[model samples]
Target: MDPIDPVHGTATLLLIAAAAVVVLLFLIIKVKLHAFIALVLISVVTAVAAGIPIADIPTALTTGFGSTLASVALLVGFGVMLGRLLEVTGGAQVLADTLVNRFGEKRAPLALGVAALIFGLPIFFDAGLVVFLPIILTVARRFGGSLLFYALPAAGAFAAMHALVPPHPGPVAAGTLLGGDIGVILLVNLPIALIAWYVGVYRMSKVLGRRFDVGLPSLLFGEENDGTGSSGDTDTKTQAPPTFGLVLGLLMIPLVLIGFNTVLSTLIESGTIAEGNILVDGLILLGNTPVALLITVLAAIALLGTRGGRTLGETQQLLDSSLGPICSIVLITGAGGMFGGVLQISGIGDALTTSLGGLGIPLLLQAFLIATALRVAQGSATVALTTAAGLIASQAADLSNVQIALLVTAIAAGATVLSHVNDSGFWLVSRFFGMDEQTTLKTWTVMETTLGLSAFAVAAALYPLVS
Candidate 1:
């Protein structure tokens, strides 16, 4: 539907801005340009293209950059460090091994799937993949199974949590930005995610199994080498896995604290922060994701460092190495924020949202479609999500809590569709699964598309219920 309103101009401007984002992502990822630099370059391009006054454009850019970085920088940075510590200590593998031992053979895929669901509850998707990949590989080998079986289930489990759960960064970030309840998001999304994963980890994987052969694909990066006990990878030891207490405690601290604070703030009758509840206060403080992750990083440093008899220098080195690749991601995402913020402030989003009015589609579907188009083009789910959220945030006031939760999931699913050469996740999975680029495109990428569309299909199914 077309509208003959002033926002029509704004709508066009935003469509251009959104398209610029995907183009920018494509250039960076497919053209081998660095994402960080590409994002900055694109932000400037968007500013000029939006016809933002020269005087205000720079400020808009700076404000967007600063605000966006402040929102997610700490969580992403600390999360990177935490995942690194976990990986280097063999903690991720140890956990999977322990779980498989407990769950046994008849249902190994189920066991790995469950491991991903639980472990993914507290970590970012990329970080989770890097840490858990080793264990997944090990399990695949142990069960005499195809990599597709274990990897698909594991990916399904992880994807479900990443898309639907809270205290993990995506939903939490969406919640904080929109003033939605982290607790309610967790409560609401748990069932949706569980329901989705039931379809994904179990049924979806099996359904798609014939199309994808298992075992590490030969074309996977460095797959032929096997790189055992390398200095970069986890080293095996006679020692037990990192203490269950340490692992479980690190994972739960953020959830419990964040949940506690959310409840206390929502339910507490007294206006003032109680003076004697220092422990709860502390938990709440620890629960602020960045702080919680920092604490987890500290926990890993202490437990993993001492247990492995690593020196302080070595410990720091491990942490640093873990974060090496993430710096670009954080910065690129920040640039994306700047790009998103500019569109919002420039009144472009308002124009677009208004244009979509009276289209007779559910707002959630609108959100998903816009996000999916961007994702299918660029392959960066983060950009797809941030861009879509920035646009939809314009219409947020009109939505209910259930609707907001659905929108968040919708945005996530949209961002996940059609991983092409441009998406890092494609390459990561491609390399991990040992597919050549084409095969990776054929299988791993298609799986992601399946995930993105199916999640929305379920979300759409639930819309009438919510309405």
Candidate 2:
């Protein structure tokens, strides 16, 4: 039998949910506990408090965690492995160097940001940042300026893409739960996403970078090593880098494949092609995000790893090593889903939204605000987005495809806001850039808020036309 929430009142359940979030924040940031542990603890406590039967609590937790992981874990694992191969094989440097040269020294930050935007398409924010860290450091060392000038643009690009675009967990999960068409969401949001990148990230990074003249760290790129054991190796200094064309082709593979999927599905939907044809089925299969990424990874292993002179054993080792760091990320994301699931089963989202629904706010704005609140409260963008989508999904059923896509963009915008002590991305940026907590708040936090708010503004402005 399915378990039911024991709580009788919506108001009471909402309060319990709020208290659970507070405890979660306290445990993680104030008490210095691990996030995965904290999220699991809160999920269980909140479940019990919401009157979930003792016998069903375990099922509730696992269902949430497993469902999230089912979608997230494979994509993250494959994406990171692909990125690691590129990074280690010098493919990333080739792309970075080519873009910087073409864009000129004065536009170095723009070049890096552009490269990041492309790289960010298939990769998650954290993995993309980690992969790009060495290049960011190398450029800063050569150019002799504050790392922020070089770093923020790239960071913001990844952040923007991750939040707004699909195949990234945040938007994908949000779209899935909201009943938004993934292809339509990707197509409709592309222009807005680019504009958001330019307005929120590209232009703003320069101002913030100049305002905060932070220094580059001494051993920041230590993880990036040459085959000869020297740390912080680059193409120009030692070996022949992979050709820019080759690197670019590799990066474009996933994008093209995924885009093909989007286009083919659209064609099928419009009755341009028979839906059940074998060729159509095969094309769609290849276009699946995870499958596309998997193909890209195998291609990278052969071209980048094997052709680049690494043995099979060495390539295997690199892929294995990449998985270790991401285990924590995967676990925390799953736990966040678990927490969101608990809130869902207890009817907190429905209860809270019903109370807020009477405020007569537009559904677009409502989505953005609810997502923003969840983001600030929980510090996990995927959880905030998925939870917010769940809350508003029923109400949004009558909206058009374009409207649903815009709503997804707004929710993504809200999910991107206010990185602080509670957010893991904040610390990752802080540590990598060698900024103290206060400086991180000033620079990274400010960049994030700007990115979120600008995207929200653009999405809000475009809502009228779509509606």
Candidate 3:
């Protein structure tokens, strides 16, 4: 019986992976450890424990870094830079200002919900946080409530896009890996994600806001947000807020390009456009071309600035600032991909996919359970998303491409569950709310669980109806 063989003993490999989670969690939660350092340790632990040679660790790490970073680095780089600018120039502050002032104390959550839903579509979860956190800081100061109230909404908004939207890297890569139709997948999950945002984000934030007070300890606060005041708000005048139109225009470049590519490709395939026509090819280049976000970021830097009424040099500096926050998340996600890559190359994913598929469990449920397990173990949603996507794509070959896309989103939702000590998000919440780890666990973790279960629940109800 080969240990990695699916039929004979593949469960042992999975069990080993499962056990690694417990060990990793202990290191972080019990030891008061750093996640950046911890994730690297876990990657090595997972590989060797599953029987990979210690000598091959370097190769595995490189492979993971190259593959995951190739897809995410650009988007993340742009996100970081853009978020830094938004933070410095008071773009997010503008949104927070309007919402907090208009809604008042009782309805900050609703404002958060709307803000997250709107802003979440364009950027990754953490990027959105870096960009918009000043707003959360402002709201917390005005209302004297938990940062979780606004943070959860912002988190959910980005989560929805990461899980449901196209070209977001996670689902896009998964969809490609599984031969799924990207457009079909987006259309199917779009409405469902919208509903989940309302119930999972809005209602939960409102409840949590009332129940908990949010912000970080004085020491952590001083370290993370400097000169931002005791409540973490540094802006005094609120002079000129960033223009909504400009901010949104900058965000739309990638979306429009990708969408145009999808549509033009469809038309080309249908023979509606002559093959190889310059006009058709130009349109395709606009959207389908690789490095879409890269190009957009450059354009944004050009368009935004003092000459055009964007705070001079703020956009450039903003992008520069986003990189500081990028280190931990990028490395953490890269490590997860490294483990997943080993599973992919080792045929472990194949074995597990086959073994699980035979159980008659719906792919949706299987996605939920797998994501939940890894998330609880490692406490990284990206890790959960990457691992589940890798494993499920192996099994999903037989599924309709549309179904495959939905599965990607479903896995994302599941991995979203149980964010705690090992998860950076938990700390982000804790820092924002000024709560210790324990209370952060009670609220932030629950908000994440709501996102995970509610997303699955929503997808489950819709699966039958759609299928």
Candidate 4:
């Protein structure tokens, strides 16, 4: 539900918007408030201050929150289930081990990063990193160098993919809000994301690794007996890890289905095929992001769970457990959407568009700058990207397909930059890597900036060709 703006003037709405952001930052960062609560509180304040009808505020808040959740909740839920299946059954280890063996020790970081890029496709950053922690530590200990050499590349890969690609909530929410085609986004993002990661994260981490001498921790997350690279499931003692080929197949299924949808839609649009063709109709259902994920999750359970020796009941329990840790993320994401909705309804978006629209800056640049400012201000990439996309939605209406997709990537790149004290990712990486705040700023923060700017540069370069 798009909120009707009660406040008419640009200056008034702009001041109110600015105050909302400052208050939000103060509450979340300085006051140590929970992000979900902080966002909800600030959103309400923004609405009231912007002269939203007091009686209609509830409608605006729910409209934004519900709409965002309609797209996000399903993807996140299915994706997490799939990731949990892989992690519990040791498929992640199979993939990691195969890559490391194939790439050799000298190029360990590259190999880990590649494997992460693959697994990271269906997983959130924090959860993915946790699942891969044992593997990263194992590689670091074997190679005998600073953990950052291996850890940074892998973490950077997850961070890059999560920020820039679809089916992860950030890009998906931004794409949905900006009216970009999800299938097109998936298609164009692959090559761009890969190159950006290699240049920004992979090579950059190698350079930074030489500068920082971070020691590998003998233990992490209080798991004392953490020798095995498995998901700490002692019950999987008797079960053999799934073969690498099998794991790879399960991961590829969703991508194939999604690609099929993209190609079919393109063909239909070009008049090569009719839109109502039975084949097209059927394929569309299978290719939808949520449906593709649902099918993948079922396949993972069947192949990795029941057929791999675990009972259906146990598998059900595992999938159910995956939801618990992610509840906060899901809620926070919804709240972020609500905040963006308030900005939209309060006329702040239109105000910015009107005042700043004539700067002659490219739509992609404006997206990046706005997203970067929001990320720096609020410290949540999902929030920043969605809010930025919402603010810029009016302008994106005239952009070509490729331009819209690239603009989404640009916003994502902006959101990815500068993880710092206010950003939860900063703390996540710092604690997981056993680095102090200062070292985290030097290594993790620097790596993030490199990744973001590099991706944005790639998008900017592609902009002219597409535009």
Winner by TM-score: 2
lDDT of 3 by residue, 288-322 (tens): 42355666657655654443244545545545544
TM-score of each: 0.67, 0.74, 0.69, 0.70
The C-alpha stretches of model 4 lying farther than 4 A from their native spots are: 6-8, 115-195, 203-225, 234-237, 307-309, 360-449, 455-467
Estimate, for each residue in 35-148, the C-alpha lDDT of model 1 and write its tens digit.
Answer: 567767777876677667667777877876776667566765666566555545656556556776788766777887876777677655654564456566656655554577
Q: On a 0 to 100 scale, what is the lDDT of residue 124 in model 1?
A: 53
RMSD in angstroms between candidate 4 and the native structure over all alpha carbons: 6.1
Between candidates 2 and 3, the TM-score winner: 2
Residue 344 of model 3, lDDT score? 44
Q: Give the clashing residue pairs of candidate 4, or none.
A: none
Give the candidate order by descending TM-score. 2, 4, 3, 1
Instruction: Give all candidate RMSDs, comma-separated.
Output: 6.5, 5.2, 6.0, 6.1
Candidate 1 shows a clash count of 2
Q: Which 10-residue window in model 4 sums to the lowest lDDT? A: 218-227
Model 2: ten consecutive residues of lowest lDDT: 228-237
Which residue pairs in candidate 1 collide? 147-215, 217-434
lDDT of 2 by residue, 376-441 (tens): 654667777898898889988888888889999999998898876445566567655777656877
What are the per-model numbers of colliding residue pairs?
2, 0, 13, 0
Rank candidates by lDDT, best first. 4, 2, 1, 3
Candidate 2 accuracy as lDDT? 0.75
